[model samples]
Target: MKIPILIVMLLLLTSATSKKMWKTRYFTKHVVQQQDTWCVHACMEMSFGIPQCMALHRWLEYSQQLIFPTLNCCDLITPDNYCNCVEHGGVARSEISSFLRQQFSPISGVFTDLWDFLPRGDIVQLAFLSVRYTSTYHLVVLREVEQVEDYLWDILYCDPEVGYSTRVYNPNKLEIIY
Candidate 1:
């Protein structure tokens, strides 16, 4: 009887402790955008820890119903080709925010000043003007912010355009929409 009781107590303790450990072990995976226009989808995947294809499929479904009534689901197999079927080849900020709120939890307010409002290690979708293209906007995932000095800070992000993670110092024209 004592042996069985001891075994039950040990099993209960292990299960209880394992739950706490599992929560702390949660981490986001770095997902690269499969296509040029899938940057926002990739950011969503990284932030929510979902697959990029899943994000695209869900967003496409959502947008088709409300925003793009005439939109057709063409070439479902190829995401890159499917992106071209959209009007702008990308989604607007308002649409992205609305989708996020309805699909996931509500995000914080839009912050133009990254250093002032954003906290460290907070994953956020960032919008900025394209450096290579003229008057074009691009989206990336802001993975982390590390303060380098009193006024200087390093911004780490996953750039879907380049399909990798890169760091920049004091990026300009940054728009954070939750």
Candidate 2:
């Protein structure tokens, strides 16, 4: 009887130890708010885990090529320039900000299982099919979260202007995979 009881207790202990450890996670607080069409910049920051300003500056480098081949990082983010390209793929106030808000086609937020990729500590760039809570024509980053049951996990994310939504992602509702 003692041997059986010992075995049962040890088994229970081992089962608990073997269970997967779960945790909740999210992006940095430096997420840029949706201001002056800064959704893309904010998304970039969330995706890259950098400051909003740095994301904007880096985007200046990435989009500069698309807007104008001759433009450089410094040319777009200078004190006077600030990516104020009113023409081309760019827009005023900040070229990166305006272009992100297509205001038409291309949609907002990608229809993806953001939760699927969050566990790996990956930051994915997403364009939503609809306005995700408070953002429009913006980019956002989905952070990885570890939970014992995915059903209980509300994916943590930051819109251009806000950080972390209260709502959670339901796989059943989001059937469109793309």
Candidate 3:
């Protein structure tokens, strides 16, 4: 009887220790609790064009899940509040602030999720769909997110015949993968 009791107590102690260890590991780490691809897809659509954003926003709103929201390019701008161009100039602090003011507007706080250069490339995938060559810069949109790490991640998209791209952002200009 004494030996059996000892074995039960040891087993219970081991189980409790393991459970506590797991709880610590899970809670202490900054793990992303949820990942909604529709959010990602809608973001990509915003990157692609204004027409698409409008259309997708309507669709998401009409759809059942209601998990994501529609975006407005004009909301990304100020004074006009409907312009689709962020790169009217380069990203300066003042420009970004103006953009943010528009973004955080009390009526509609859209574009809040828009990322600056440093944190922009969070969850995108580049499939190298096609490339465009402008007089000044080249552009590409990859297909899928290639890697995700604690610090950063990569999306595999097409660009102007260049190698892999690490995106850079500024308040004055908004660069999209598509």
Candidate 4:
């Protein structure tokens, strides 16, 4: 009886010690948008763990070869020049997808029910209508999703415009993008 009890306690202790604890993992450094129209670029930087200038340069290089062959990074130093280069005011989603595919392996897809499918520690892009400007759209990187309770969840994200990572309680306003 004593031997059996000792073995049972040892097994329980071993199992408890071997069990892994859940942890919230996200990007430690937040990358902020360098320019007004560079929100997507900043999000990309945060996702790729690259610097702001490098992200901008990579985008410029990709854009020059495909969208505007004549545009150069130095030419967009001034606000007017940058605005002229980006005639649409912001980068398009298709452009972002194409760039990601070309530079890295195609690793994203559109998912409407993100909360159910999103994996922990994976970075994703989200699009939603701007709170301040209802007619405009904004983008951010979803860093982590934590379940607070049975039906509630906490969303951790990096907002390029805000220049930091923020946690919100069950944000239902945003749409997840690849």
Tens-place lDDT per residue, model 3, 44-146, is: 3323332423433443433323444344533554554533233222222223333323322221112222133224333222212222234333223333332
Please say which candidate is ahead in lDDT: 2 or 3. 2
Once fitted onto the true fold, the runs of candidate 3 whose alpha carbons sit more than 4 angstroms away are: 1-135, 160-174
Runs in model 4 deviating more than 4 A are: 1-28, 53-89, 119-133, 171-173
Error of 2 at 90 (Å): 9.4
- The candidate, 3 or 4, that scores higher on TM-score is 4
RMSD of 4: 6.2
lDDT per residue for candidate 2 within 54-142, as digits (tens), equals 54454554565443346443345434554543122222333433444342122232344534334432333333322334433444444
User: After best superposition, candidate 2 residue 43: deviation in angstroms?
Assistant: 3.9
What ranking emerges by lDDT with the best candidate at the front? 4, 1, 2, 3
- Per-residue CA lDDT of candidate 4, range 113-173, in tens? 5454445223433322122246555677766565655445677677889888777777464
Q: How does each model score on lDDT?
A: 0.55, 0.42, 0.30, 0.57
Q: What order do you get sorting by TM-score, best first?
A: 4, 1, 2, 3
- TM-score to native of every candidate shown: 0.60, 0.42, 0.20, 0.60
Error of 2 at 108 (Å): 20
What CA RMSD would you report for each candidate?
A: 11.9, 8.5, 16.1, 6.2
Position 129, candidate 4: lDDT: 18
* Poorest lDDT segment (10 consecutive residues) of candidate 3: 20-29
